[model samples]
Target: EADIYQTPRYLVIGTGKKITLECSQTMGHDKMYWYQQDPGMELHLIHYSYGVNSTEKGDLSSESTVSRIRTEHFPLTLESARPSHTSQYLCASTKATQETQYFGPGTRLLVL
Candidate 1:
């Protein structure tokens, strides 16, 4: 298995509904990140945390939000999901600086 996991590989929701994309890592990495990406584009850092209680918004980390409560868990929640929120959400974590990041399969969301 990879270092991370994301549930509900695909989701189709209504115009307004509460949803959360699950992400977890077992590598005990202190650095965790959430990225929004399309099929054929570079990954965009939406949120990142250096360590516990150290969540910082990334440069391109907007239009979405994330939380870092547990060291091994970092989940993204949408209060009201909209059609404009439809995209692939990827979860990644790094063990240390200058290290490769491991990405989850991602959750493909489609809002209607």
Candidate 2:
């Protein structure tokens, strides 16, 4: 299954509601990331983790969120949904020695 899973492949919600997108991997990589993008959106790092209990924000990505208590999962939650929150969320990971990342198909979010 490409080692990753994203639920609600597509979502449409009323504005101002809390939302959480799920991401899980089975490869057991130490690095994980979350990104936001538009239809043809460029990847913007929203969140990431280096290892178990080691999470850090990325420069290219926005100020989203991520956690790594379990190496195979990384989920992002928005406190309040907004029209601006409407974008694509993509999850990715790379090996400790390799910088090449693997990406999920993505979750399409629309806040109305």
Top lDDT model: 1
After superposition, the stretches of candidate 2 with alpha carbons farther than 4 Å from their true spots are: 60-63
Writing each residue's lDDT as its tens digit, candidate 1 over 48-106 gives 98988778777674656678888999988888999988889898999999898898999
How many angstroms is residue 63 displaced in model 2 relative to the true structure, after the best TM-score fit?
Answer: 5.3
Q: What would the TM-score be for candidate 1 when compared with the true structure?
A: 0.92
lDDT tens per residue, model 2, 1-112: 4677888799999988888888888887888888888888577887788888988887664535666778888888887888988889998887876667888879999999
Q: Estimate each model's TM-score.
A: 0.92, 0.89
Each model's lDDT comes to 0.87, 0.82
Reference-based TM-score, model 2: 0.89
